[model samples]
Target: MKFKNLLLSWKYPSILLLGIGISNFGAWVYFIALNLIVLDLTNSALAVAGLYIVKPIAALFTNVWAGSVIDRINKRNLMVALDLFRAVFIALLPLTSSIWVIYSVVFVINMAGAMFGTTSRSYITKLIPIEQRKRFNSLRSLIDSGAFLVGPAIAGILFLIGTPILAIYINAVALFLSGIITLFMPNLEKDRSLEQSDSSLSWKIIKQDWAIVLNFSRQYSYIMFMHFLFSCMMVMATAIDSQEAAFAKAVLFLTDTDYGFLVSIAGAGIIVGALVNTMIVSKIQISFLIGLGSLFVSVGYIIYSFSSSFSIAALGFFIIAFSLAFANTGYQTFYQNNIPVEIMGRVGSVFGLLEACLIIITTTIVGVSAQFISIQFVVITGSIIMFALTILLFILSMKPSKSRYYSVKSVEAKDL
Candidate 1:
C-alpha cells in the first residue's frame, strides 16, 4: 500500500523521467554514430572535430532568442514539438552525404536542442514542487549516468549487427518515442494567463527581457554569482577536457585501449555516486552538495593534472565523475528553488549564452596554448583556476546569512 501510494504521487515525474532517459540514451547513440559516419565520409580527423563545433555555434545563434519563445509557449507542447523536430532532422542525417549539408542539419537540430533545454528547465520547475526537486534531480542524475554507460554500448552492438546508419535510425525512433511519452504529461500552463499585450517577439522585447534579467541579477546578486561561478567552473573543465586525449598520449603515455578503459571507470564512478546520492540526498544539505561536491570535482582534476601514469589519471576521472552527480543535483535544485519560474527561461538563456561564448573562447585559448607550450602546463593551469573558483564558491555557499537559498522549505514563486 505504501509503495502504491508513493508511485501514485510520483506518476507525472516518473513519466517525465522516462522521456528524459530515452532521449538522453538516444542522444549518446546519435553522437557516437554520427561521429563515425562523418569520419567515414570525410576520412579527416578535423572533419570529425567539426561535428563538435556545430552545437555551440547553434547555441550561440539560438540562445539569444530561445528563452523568449520558451517563456511564452506551453512548455510540454514545445518540448514534444522540439523532440519530433529533432527526430526528423536526425532521420534525415543518413541521407545526406555532403559535409556542409550535414552540418547545416545538425545545426538546426542543436538549435532545437538548446531551446528544449531551457524550456525543460522552466517546465520542470513548474511541474515539480520545491520539496521534491532534489529527489527528482538525483534520480535524473542516475538515469543520465546509466545512459552514459549504456548508450555507447548499444551503439557498438548496433554497429556489429548493422551500421552507423542503423544506429541513427534507432536514435530517431527513440526520440519519436520520447516525444510520444511526453504527450502524456500534464500541461502546467493550461490555467495560466499571459500578461503581455503583444506576444510576438522582437528586438525591443528581447532587449526588455535582457533588462529584466539584469534587474533580477542586481536584486539577487548572490544567486546570480552562484550561477556565474558554476558556469566558469564548467568552462574551465571543458577547456581542460579538450586536451584530454593529448594529455593521455603525451604525458601519461596511455594507449587507446587504456584511455577507453579509463573512460569506463569514470562512467562507473558516476553510476556509483549517483546511486549513493539517490539514497542519501534527503539527508544532505544542498549547499554541501554544491560547494563540497564541486570542490572535490576540481580536486580530482588537480590530481589528474599532476599525474604521470594512466592509473593516476583513471583515479582522477573516477573522483571527478563521482562528485559530479551531487554537484549537479544540488545546483539544479537550488536554481529551481530560488529562481522565480516566471523569469527562469530568460535567466537560463541569457546566462547560457554567456557560458557558450566562454566555452568557445576558453577552449580556443587552451588548444592554442597547448600547441605553443605544453599540454600538461595548460591543463594544470586550467585545473588550478577551476580549483580556486570552486573554493570561492564553497566559501560563498557556507555563509550563514545566505542559508535561506539552500532551504528545502516550500516557497511560492511570487514570494521569491
Candidate 2:
C-alpha cells in the first residue's frame, strides 16, 4: 500500500488510535516501573509474579460483563469513560509504597482496560470497511507495538535520570493526556433496537443465537490453541533470559547496558515485522502466512536454547518478532472479516479472556518451573510444543472443512 492510502485509510480511526496508543504506552510504562519497584521492595520473583497474576484474573471476569456492556452502550463514550477511570487508578500508583495497594490498583486498572479493549475493537469494526480491515488492523498493531517499544526505553531513561517514582509520575501524566484526547472522538453508538428488548438478557439472545460470536471461537480453535502454546514458550524464554542476565555479567563479562541494547534489538525487529505485515500480507491468505510464521518462531526459540553468544540470541529474537507479527495480523484479520459487526465486541472479548487465561497459566508455569529445572530445558520444551502446533495447523489448513473455517464466506452462505 502507498503511504497516502495508509494515511487516508486512518482518517476515521486516527483520533481513537492516537488516544489508545498513548494510554497503552502509559500502561506499559507503569508495568515496567511497577515490576522494578516491586523487585526492589520485596526482592521476590514470586511477589512480582503475584502482581502480574491480577491482570488475567481481572480480564477473565470483567470481559464477559464488558462485552455485554459494549453491545448495549455507545462505543465512543464507553471508551472515554474507561480511559478516565483507568487514569484515576494509574494516578494512585505513585502515592503508595505497599505491595498490596499496588496489586489492588493494578487489578482495577486491568478491569477497566478490558472493558476499553473490547469496546475499542468493536468500534473499529464499525469505523472501517471489511475489505480494508487487514490493513487497518495491521496499522493498529504497529501503533501499539510502537508504544510498547518506546514506553520501556523511555521509562528506563527517565529512571536513570531521576527515579522510578518520577517515571511513574510521567506515566500518570500520559494516561491523563490519553483520556483528554478520548473525550474529543466522534460519537459512535451501537444499534439500540437490538439491545433494548427484554429478551436481550435471556441466555439465547446473550449467548446462544449469536452464531457470529460462536463461530469466531469455534472456527479458530486450533489457531487459538497454538497461540496459547506460543505464549507459554515466550514466557519460558523470558524467565530463562531473566535468570541468564546475571550469568552474562558474571560469566561472560557483559554489562547491563549491553543486555538492554540486545532487548531493544528485539523490539526493533517487532516494529519491522509489523510494517512488513501491513505492507505485504494485507492482500494475502492469512492461514498459510501464519503457519509459516509459527514455523519461524518455533525454530528461532529452539535455536535460542543452544545459543552461547549474544549475536546468536539476537538473531533468534528477530525471528520470534517476525513470527509474532505474522500470527497476530492473520488472526486479527480472520476475526474482523468473519464476524458480524454487531457481535464483534462479545466475540472479541471472549477471545481476549481465553488468551489472557492461557498467558497467565503459561507464565506462572514457567516462573515456577525455573525453581526446579534449567531454563534452557523449559524453553526447548516450549519450542517443541509450538513446532508441533504449527505442523498440526499446517495439516489442518490443507483440509477443506478446516480451511473453510478460516475463509470469509458471506453471511447467507455462512448460514447455510
Which parts of model 1 have CA positions greater than 4 angstroms off? Answer: 191-198, 409-416
Task: List per-prediction Cα lDDT, in the order shown.
Answer: 0.91, 0.69
Choose the strongest candidate by TM-score. Answer: 1
Q: Give a tens-digit lDDT track for model 2, residues 311-401.
A: 8877877887766777667656655555566666776677677777776667667656755875556656666766676666555545666
* Cα RMSD for predicted model 1: 1.8
Which number leads on lDDT?
1
| lDDT score, candidate 1, position 11 | 99
Q: Put down candidate 1 lDDT per residue, 1-416, tens digits, no spaces.
A: 99998888799999999999999999999999999999999999999988877878888999898887777778888888899999999999999999999999999999999989999999999899788899999999999999999999999999999999999999999999999999999978875333332368999899988898898899889999998999899899988999999999999998899988988999999999999999999999999999999999999999999998888898999999999999999899989988888888889999999998999999999999999999999999999999999999999999999999999663345554
Deviation in angstroms for 90 in model 2? 0.7
Clashing residue pairs in candidate 1 are none
